[model samples]
Target chain A: MEKETHQNIESIIEAGKMNELRKLLIGLSHEELERLQKLLNDPHEFSNEISSLLPYAIRKMVERGEISVDSLLPFVEESMHKSIQKNPQKLADILFPVMGPAIRKAVSEDLKRMIASINASLESGFSFRSLKWRLQAFTSRRSYAEIVMANSYLYHISNVFLIHKDSGILLHEASAPESKALEADLIASMLTAIRDFVQDSFSNAEKGTLDEIQFGSLKILIEQGPYAVLAVVAEGQPPADYRVTLMETIEAIHFNLGLELEKFDGDTEYFKLADKFLQQCLIKQKKEKKQKAPYQLIFLLLLLIAGVGYFVLINYENKANFKRFITELEATPGYHISSSRMSFNKIYLKGLVDPLAEPVEEIMKRFQKIEPGTLQASFEGYLSTEPEILQRRAGLLLSPPEGVEMKIENNRLIISGTAAADWEQNLELKIAAIAGITGFDISGLNKKITDLQWIIPSIERHRFLFDINVVKLDSLQQIQFDSLVQAAVFLDAYNQLYSRNMAIYVRSYTNRNGNVAANERVATARAEGFITLLENAGVKKALLKSQVLFAEDLRETVSLRTVHFSVFDNKPISR
Target chain B: MIKKKIAMLGAFAVGKTSLVQQYVHSIFSDKYQTTIGVKIDQKQITVADQDITLMLWDLYGDDDFMKMKPTYLIGASGYILVADGTRSETIEVALQLQEMAAATTNNAPFLLIINKSDLSETWEIAPETILRMQQKGWIVLLTSAKKNLMVEEAFQKLASLMLNPY
Candidate 1:
């Protein structure tokens, strides 16, 4: 019966019908068939061949929802224990070549569930050793020693993988390496393939205007086992020569593969080593994940905090900008008609004011005083039309006298009317009060009449005196009029005495001498009087300063006969 | 505050150290000291009401450094590539450094510092050559550590460029 069952199983396998094989096993006796089935399933259960099948089956089961990850885990654990008991060595042997595919399949099949399970178990403080044991059971025979060693290798490889993966993803989104490289040739080939693919895609996408394609690749060789390659293609073309040079990269990788494996051994042994490595990786990944979880969470928390901070900062900046706008508006010069309608930070003002007026300094100063930094004003009123109203108001404020007429047109103030002398100041003030007035025309204005000649005469006299003393003289010679008067006092006294004597002589000559007779006597008397005056003034041997000679000297100088002859005829007529 | 990371790269024995020493220490060293890996120093400065931290990296003088490991050039905000004023060959190195920096960082702000300007009589590189290089998108500045000419200015300008980044 066992032979028939074996033959039937062999036929089903030959026909490539696994379902039939399973169905045929049910027909044999339970004890014998169970033994045969266990034997038949042992290779698939413990070997690397099962590595391929397991992923496929798990994927299908997951897709169909026939087996949840929680339900599948126990079976995986049992299989791992059974394989290890059956042949720990064989299970270890299959791991190296198949580790790449196995890991890839595992990740692809149920990345979300695996991540969740790992995270959940990690939170519960389940040790990495426990996780490694589980992974080893799913993939191979679970030996404690193999699992421990495998955990360490996996830790190193996963670290490398994560670092390279981050770099690759940052550089290019679509092409990232799948594994780590044990061989230099694999690294080279992976780099070249990535470079070429990125260059082609970038050139095609950018229409050939790009300069360089930035990308990264992952190449992992399970020494003496299967090779896994991952390439990331960037969106731009690199240099053409670089692409050309990359074609030989695959050949180089192949060469490096030989060198890498030579450092190890045959394929089966290599896979066994890799299997141990995978086990180690699983444990290490679990441990590292547990260790890094807090950090990742912290990083996420920090990012969230930063995001909130940025948002608040942006809001503050916007508010500040709004406040600044309002302040600028308030600082401008204008009548604020809608000041109450706006907030302190968003005040608005409107009114008639000169747009091109001078010294914006005045406007700024006024605005500063009104609201400090909170107010800004701008003039939007019609400067050309409002000058008349402004002028009238200014006239009223200045208290102009009743008759003075003032008008403002186009920023020009016009005053054309007569005003009392007392109203002159008031008129000037009225014109000055008009806003935006560039100039004032008061051509027709007149002042009240008042007498001022009496006052002017004295002022003129003083001015004449001042001019004589100071204006006509050089700066160095100019002196006070009183000083000059004091210095000339004696000369004036002497002149007065001389004038009196001469006047007496003249009167005596006119009275005493009739006609010609009296003239001769008067001349003699004048000469005598001048001499007497000089003598009285303390003069000794005095002579008249004038060119006219005295009477005595004149008689002496002239001959007596000629004088008598002239006097006989003249005296006869005068007497 | 954003810290600007800048690098001083050049060929062997181009007085990069002298320039950095003059600006940082205000002293001139006649002796030549070759750098090994990378040396880092920092300075605080202000521009337009913003405080900025300038992180200056003085790389080694070996020409083969770029070829050996390009990773050292990553994360640079700006670069100052120095060349010897007396040697025209150094200018070639400067050009190569520019290319490498552009390739590494996608054209970050870069300036070319031509050192040893105190020896103008011995200079074989003409101003025209520097101008030509500048026309090709390289900023060239003449400097002399001994004279303290344009050394601080080079750093200030590079820091400003890094801060603005546009």
Candidate 2:
């Protein structure tokens, strides 16, 4: 029963408020309406004060795909324009920090895109400069990027400005962070003036704006829009498509801000987002320049020319230096050059210096700059002034037969050995040319004696010794024995040269410390051992003999306390 | 990563190039060889958790032959002064070259490597010489390119020296 009474009261209240709600609010104060008016004018005030309500509204719009980055760009621009229009002067100052980096970023990205396009065009396909690069890349089997990096020029947009197309007024500007600030208005005005002058002076046939101007390393690129113009100061050779970017930005501005700009006044506040738009067009970059490729090639070419020049110069210098070194060596006497090579960077030498010449130290002092490794030298065994050296040189120069041996004594060379032919006629002339060789002797030399007799005095004088009072050989004595055997074999071979048997004699002696009979016995055993040794070493048994002797009382070393020899020959002539 | 140039200095045939080849290529050659020019090689390694690339310069040995090219020593962060253990004078040469290398790198870290350790019996460099070098506060190592002894360690010590100077 109470629930029915409450339902009737709710219906009567709802029915009364539906008609009275609008009438009751319409009767409020002006301040309340003004408050509502402010809320309507700036939705941010209401939504922001309510916090997450604004986010929720945007989220709902986003969920329904009612908002996008592109669609929001215009709105953001509009809001910034409204705020900037409220106070142009302070707004510009206030926006400086925020817009500075933004403009730089935009300009940097646009420049990079343009540079990439240009570099791609240069490296991807073929053109004049690129053609040359491609041919080199083909020859070197390298990639186009390498060739481009090597030969291509790097470029950068140092500064960019957006100016009112007709007024040449600076609307917005951006520059590299470290770049010095330029008078944007002055540059824009100058460019506008130049453009106007060019159009007036040369546009009689067709109407076109000045597109580019150059000053040494700087270039000004211009792109005209219906409402504004973009003047870019580039430090290097920017890509041609850089103008395409400027034109696109201008077209975007025209599409988004054309209506407001058309009703333009002197106010720049409506273009508050221009800095952001300009920044979106920036770019900067540089490539590695080894400076090596072209320089190395050029250096190689120069090296080729210089190589020949150096060769000629060095040839003359080498000849002169050769002469000087030879002259100095000859003037000092007794220095002989075996080999030498003189070059610009280095000089190589090998020679023999006689003691009769300057001291090696003195010779080396002349070559203070040359290191020891380059100046190779040794002492000379013979000087040309010596008779032995004279004879030797003559012998070598004359090349006498094997049997011909030359001996020099007291300035006279004795060429007494036999020769294949009596080349004495030529020998006299050759020998006379050799200094210190005053005369010749050809007497003792016989040409092929059908019967020959030879004696080896040095081999004969060799002693084959024994240990004290003992005939058994020790290790030291055995060494002498083996040597003796070897000598005997050589002697026998030499004797065979004349078809003769070399006689081997072993005369043994004892020091006076032992009894005469015992010593004689020991001496005899030592001589017999020597005979056995020679026989074993291939000496003819018929050629061996032994003799025992006695020596005065003086103890001798074991090696010298025995029989020595005197070798001679008996001939069986092969001739 | 930082690139530090390290030069090899010593007398002729003292195994400077061999040390570099062993360290870089991980291979040793028994044959003794010499170089006439600066041979540059690169290796990447980590020291104290920092990546570093070593630009090794194998220059020709200096002695009775050519003088060491001072230009090659320029910009070096460190150096390896090698000497033949079989040749005592090579130690003196290494010391002298160290002075030269020092001038170029402003006395950067260096190691005195007495190379040819495989032929210890033939060593003519006196123990006193090595002791003297050590006494002078020089870091000394006995290396054998033939046996690859201490080759990698020598390079690592130098790398660490470059990373943390003093």
Candidate 3:
């Protein structure tokens, strides 16, 4: 039977009849059947089973702390780095959305910080502290901004040096970006020397190393490790926790680089790794204060506005005054403004001006709104034909005497006064040559008559004596009549000298020794004879007129015949 | 680049400071030598395509008035023992300073520089003494601070020895 079963099984296996075999072992070995099932899966079935269990396996591993995120970070970073290196565009596309706001946020933060710093500095710019900082900057050979930040910050580590304890050599150094670079190698050695010097001098320092060294505003904080020392050069007051950070950094260096520090031997190549720790100590914190309102800027702005307003107001007034001055000049009789402009706080004018015109300085003095010496004027001299100028010109040239008055009216020169004869003659000669005078009138003038009036009195005083019955002249009477003729000749000469026509009268007087008719007739005959004699003595016959008059006093006193000569001016010229 | 501290040691008025002045930048004045007993300077030199910076601690001259402090040479990688060629007694002082520096730095590399070689008329050190020192495994060099002769060579040689010590 067994041989028969074996043959069947062999035949079934050879014929690929697994269904019959499954029936054979279905209840006998289920565990073996499950193993066989698992072992007999196809490629697709294997893949599907693994996919189902992968996520759960990973989750379990993560929960149990068997696989850490730290372990996966490098793989992810490496994969991303490779992907970016292969196709940078894809990485850029993925990060674009995040980068835009990130960049904007970072830039805005930096800008806000910068603006705050600028505002703070500007506010302090007017303070006495700012002046002190400026002086310190000059004396310390440092930048003003550096000095300002030095004083403004609450605490700042400018430079951090890692030095070997035994060698006193610089292992590594880190500095703030804004800090000035120093010769760290030299400084490290010098610091070591100073430490050694202190240790040597003070007996109390045997158990302790230098912890702090104060240099004005700068403070050196020294943290000693087993093999190395960390020195931080700081400004302002560092918080107590700052020492903790420095201590931690120094301990980390000693722990991580213990073997290297022990074997330093002036070779700093290995200590470069300590820079990361050293840089962590270059910390800073700014002082906090309320944001003050920008009053100084506002004040400056107001002052600028007030200054500009004052300048503009002054400019406007000056312009108006300049216009008024130009107008005044134009309206004047002898000034003409051709070009006018303002430059350099000055008014420049070019034009023509009559010599007799009102002075420009006098006009300028009237406008106090304009600055002194601000009027630069260039004027060419010109003769003006205006009436007022012409009148002035006539006065200047003629120099009329005190009593004489000259005026210009309707282009005519009118003169009126009592002038000397010579001056009157001069007026007649020069009046026509004056420019702008169409005509002249001197009709109101009078010439003073000097010696002509005296002639009348002298002529009247000459008298001739004649007998009552004798109409003929005797020798003595002829001599007396000659005297009367001479006096008559003097009157005629004066009349000619003065260019006047006057009448010389000859009169006869009779006494009471004769009858009235006979005396009158005799007197008339005597005057007629006297006139004939005066006329014959070179006096004009027309100028010598005869008259007979009875003398009452002489008629009562004595019977004497008298002939008198007198002269009267036809047109008397006042002296 | 490598940095090393080197000391200049000798008797008073031995031209040790003058040698450093010729070969390095003296940021600290000579007054520092009188006050602090040491003036520090630095110089950069190239040897065998390697750049090295030497921190020179010019110690105040050893004399009865101001003896050099061994603390200044605590960390020096090398030293230059200077002697005035015009004074034979400075050679004995230089040898004494060498022993002190050796004790301080554990026999660090050094060079014996006979300075003021240009003052030949006043030179009092015998050449046979220099030969005797050289025979005793001392690297001896003649230098002139005034003429700047062998000043650079002496520093360059010292820097090379410091970088690649025997």
Best by TM-score: 3
Least lDDT summed over 10 consecutive residues: which range in candidate 1 chain A? A561-570
| Best of the two (1, 3) by DockQ | 3
After superposition, the stretches of candidate 3 with alpha carbons farther than 4 Å from their true spots are A1-80, A83-108, A121-132, A139-141, A203-205, A265-272, A290-575, B25-35, B64-69
In model 1, which runs have C-alpha deviations exceeding 4 angstroms?
A1-575, B64-68
Q: Model 1 compared with the native: what TM-score?
A: 0.24
Per-residue lDDT for B40-60 in model 2, tens only? 666778788877767677778
RMSD of each: 37.3, 47.8, 17.8
User: What is the per-residue lDDT of model 2 for residues A353-439, given as tens digits with 9 covering 90 to 100?
Assistant: 644455655764685444445444444555566554565566667777777788888878787766533455566688777756778
Chain B alone vs. reference chain B, TM-score for every model: 0.92, 0.95, 0.92
Better of 1 and 3 by TM-score: 3
List, residue by residue over B1-166, the lDDT tens digit for candidate 1.
Answer: 4445567788888988788788877889888888766555556667666676565666778566434134445556678999998988888887777787888766878888899888979988886898798788777888999999998889888877766767
- In model 3, the Cα lDDT at residue B20 comes to 83
Model 2: residues >4 Å from true position, as ranges? A1-138, A147-575, B30-33, B69-71, B102-105
TM-scores of chain A across candidates: 0.21, 0.30, 0.37
Interface root mean square deviation of every model, in Å?
A: 17.6, 26.0, 1.8
Give the candidate order by descending lDDT: 3, 2, 1
- Candidate 2 residue A394 Cα shift, in angstroms, is 99
